[model samples]
Target: MIKVLFFAKYRELLGLGQMTVELHSTTTVADLKNRLVKEGGDHWAQALLADNTLCAVNQTIAHDGDAIADGDEVAFYPPVTGG
Candidate 1:
């Protein structure tokens, strides 16, 4: 299982801070997002697919094509802004 974390607005959108998902096979970050959206429906789709939504794997920035492995920790959050 891979651990998925939701932060800030994502937590609000998904109503959970974290969840464990079973990986069926080799998968990428985008693949996981698609699966979550497919399973969780509209709200999940909005949270995960929002423009500029940031993702990290094992605490390092991750891209949509980055492969996710069993036991990896993945986080999703909105882009930060400050002046």
Candidate 2:
């Protein structure tokens, strides 16, 4: 299973801190996002839009093509903003 974590506005929007997902070997970060949108509903789906959200896989920023594996930690958050 892959451990999925949500942070910042994304966490608040989903009302969840984390989830464990069963995935195939070929699954990618984009695929995971699609599944999260399904499990988390419109708020999460909308928040995860590519232009607005950020993702980290195994604590490193991940691209859509990045591979996912069993027990990987995938974290999601809204884009960060600061002065």
Candidate 3:
């Protein structure tokens, strides 16, 4: 399974901090995101599909194309701003 996490604004938006997805060899970060959007419906699509949304894989910032593996943790959060 791929452990998916939501943080900060995304966590509030999604109403859950973490969830698991079935592991598939061909799955990439984008694919997993799209799956979540489908399952979570319209609300999820707004939070996850936003342009400023960011993703990390196993604690490392990742691109949409990054491949996922069993037991990997994927995190999603909105971009942060500092004064």
Best by lDDT: 1
**lDDT per residue as tens, model 2, 34-82:** 8777876788777786596888999999988899988889998888787
Predicted structure 1: lDDT: 0.94
Instruction: Quote model 3's TM-score.
Output: 0.91
TM-score of each: 0.94, 0.86, 0.91
Off by over 4 Å in 1: none
Candidate 1 lDDT, 1-83, residue by residue in tens: 99999999889988999999998887999999999999999999889999889999999999999999999999999997758
Which of the two, 2 or 3, has more lDDT?
A: 3
The whole-model lDDT of each prediction reads 0.94, 0.83, 0.88
Q: Which pairs of residues have clashing backbones in candidate 2?
A: none
Candidate 3, position 36, lDDT:
90
Q: Please report the candidate that would top TM-score against the real structure.
A: 1
